[model samples]
Each structure stands twice: as structure tokens, then as C-alpha cells.
Target: MEELTLTTPALLFSAISLIMLAYTNRFLAYAAVIRNLSEKYRERPQDSLIRQIDNLKLRLNLTRWMQIFGISSLLLCVLTMFLIYINQHVVAVWIFGTALILLILSLAFLIREIQISAQALQHHLSDMEESLKK
Candidate 1:
């Protein structure tokens, strides 16, 4: 294996930063949608609305986990750089590897969330089709 250096972990800094930004944006969008859904549910209280809210709740939890893992990865990367700075090359390599695993987990959660979102949209489209038939 190649010798681990400070610059190695530094490379992930910008990539992780951009990913965190995208996660934050996704979180904000979910919050807005939940607020709107809450108001609508309060006014009408339909079964369909309840289902949608439940789906959103699951998606929101997934989003939270995604952020947690992503942030943890970023933190680990920073720690890896610190470890290298202090001449702990072996530990730094291990930490950097763990950080990469965390990032992979975060992306996996993101894929699941996107799949759920697509399913939710499909449900809406099906409902619209049914209404049109009626």
C-alpha cells in the first residue's frame, strides 16, 4: 500500500462538503413538504393524506440517518488528516478507510430514499389516473 499523507484525506474535503450541502438541501425540502402536508391533513384528514404523511415520515428518518453517516465520514476524514499531521500514519490509514466505508453507507441510504420518493410519486400518478377514469 502507498504511504498515507495529509493530502490524501484532504482530497475528500471538497467532495464531502458538496455532499453535505446537498443533504442539507434535501433536509430543507422535506421540512417544507411536511409543513404543507401537516396543514392539509389538519383541514381534511383523509386516508390518502395519512398514507402520504407516513411515507414522508419514513423518508425523513432515512434522510436524518444519511446526514449522520455523511457527517461522521467527514469528521473521520478530518481526524485522519490530524493523525497524519501527528505522524500516526498507520492509524490515519485505518481511519481514512473507515471514513470511506461511512461515505458508502451514506450513499446507500440515499439510494433507498430516492427509491421511496419515486414510489411515492408513482402512487400519486396512479391516483390521478384513477380520478381521470372516474
Candidate 2:
């Protein structure tokens, strides 16, 4: 492979920043939902809300890891740039490659979170359908 340059890893900075921002937003929204659900659960204690809360808990965990990997990737990208600056081209390439892999893992977790969110929405829709059927 051609020698990697500092520019190559620098390119990821904006992308990773945007991704981290998105993940943070997701975390914030989930926090709001969890609080609302917790209050509702205390009031009525419905099974569906409990299950939804459980799903949200899992999603929150996934979001946390996604943020972790994404931040790690960002840090590695910076490290790779420093390596290149120090004339360590070979090590820089390896570190950049690892950063790319970490980014992919972060995206995978994002996809999983989306799937869980979709399932939760579907559950809500099904309940609406059942109510309408009656």
C-alpha cells in the first residue's frame, strides 16, 4: 500500500466529531425517555413500559460503547498524525488502520442501536393497532 500521510487521518477528524455529536444527542434523548418512563412506571407499573425501559437500557449501553470506540478512533487518528510528523511512517499506517477498524466497530454499534429503537417503535405501533382493533 502507498504510504499513508497525515492528511489521510486528518480527514477523519470532521467525520468523527460529527459522529460523536450524534451519539451524544442519542444519549441525551434516551436519558429524557428513561426519566419519563421511570416516573410512569412508578405511577402505574406497566409491563410494556418496563420492557421498553429494559430495551432503552441496552441501547444506552450500546451508545456508551459507540462513543467510547469513536473517541478512541479520534484519539488514534491524532496519534497517527503525530507519528507521521515524527517521521514514523510505518507505525503511522498501522495506527491509522486500527483507527479505521475502531470507526467501523463504532458504526456497527450504532446500527445495533437503531435496530433496537426500531423494534421498540414497532412494539408501540402494535399496541396502537391492538387498541384500534377493539
Candidate 3:
């Protein structure tokens, strides 16, 4: 492969930064929902509320893993740049490849979390439609 340039890893910096920001926003929103659910459950426990809380817990875990992989990717990119600076082309290539894979894994988890979240929303919509029918 050609020499690993600083620009190559630098390009990933922008993408990783934006991804981390999105993950953070998702985490914060989940936290808010969890807190709201907790209060509502405390006031009056319901099976549906319990299920929603369980679903949120799974989503929260997925988001956590997504953040972890994303951050790992960013760190690997920085490490790869350093390796390139030190003229370790072989190792730099491996590290850069690993970073790319981690980024893909992070996005995969993000997709899964979104799919689950959509299901939860659909449940709410279905309830509303049922009420309308009533």
C-alpha cells in the first residue's frame, strides 16, 4: 500500500467527531426517557410501563456499546496517525484497518438501536389508534 499520510487519518476525525456527537445526543435522550419512565412507574406500576423500561434498558446498553466502539475508532485513528508519523507504515495500515472496522460496528449497533426504538414508538401509535377506535 501507499504511504499513510496524515491527511488520511485527519479525514476520519471529522466523521468520527460527528458520529460521537450523534451518539451522545441519543444517550442523553434515552436518559431523559428513563427518568420519566421511572417516575411514572413509581406513581403507578403497569405491565406496559415495565416492558417499556426493559426495552429502554436494552437500547441504553446498545448505545453504550456504540459509543465505546466509536471512541475506540477515534483513538485508533489518532494512534494510526502517530504510527505514520513515526514511519511505521506496516503497523499503521493494520491500525487504520481496525479503526475502520470498529466504525462499522458502531454504526451497526446504532442501526439496531434505532430499529428497536421504532418498534417502541409503533406500540404507542397502535395504542393511540385503538383508543380512537374505542
Stretches of model 3 off by over 4 angstroms after superposition: none
TM-score of each: 0.98, 0.98, 0.97
Query: How big is the positional error of residue 113 in model 1, measured in Å on the Cα after superposition?
Result: 0.3
Which digits, one per residue and each the tens of the lDDT, describe model 1 over residues 83-125? Answer: 9999999999999999999999999999999999999999999
In angstroms, give how far residue 70 of model 2 lies from its true place.
Answer: 0.3
Per-residue alpha-carbon lDDT of model 2 for 44-111, expressed as tens digits? 99889879989999999999999999999999999999999999998998999999999999999999
> In model 2, where is the ten-residue run with the lowest total lDDT?
1-10
Q: Which candidate leads in lDDT?
A: 2
**Which is the better candidate, 2 or 3, if ranked by TM-score?**
2
Clashing pairs in model 2, backbone N/Cα/C closer than 3 A: none
lDDT of 3 by residue, 1-134 (tens): 47789899889999999999999999999999999999999999999999999999999999999999999999999999999999998999999999999999999999999999999999999989999999
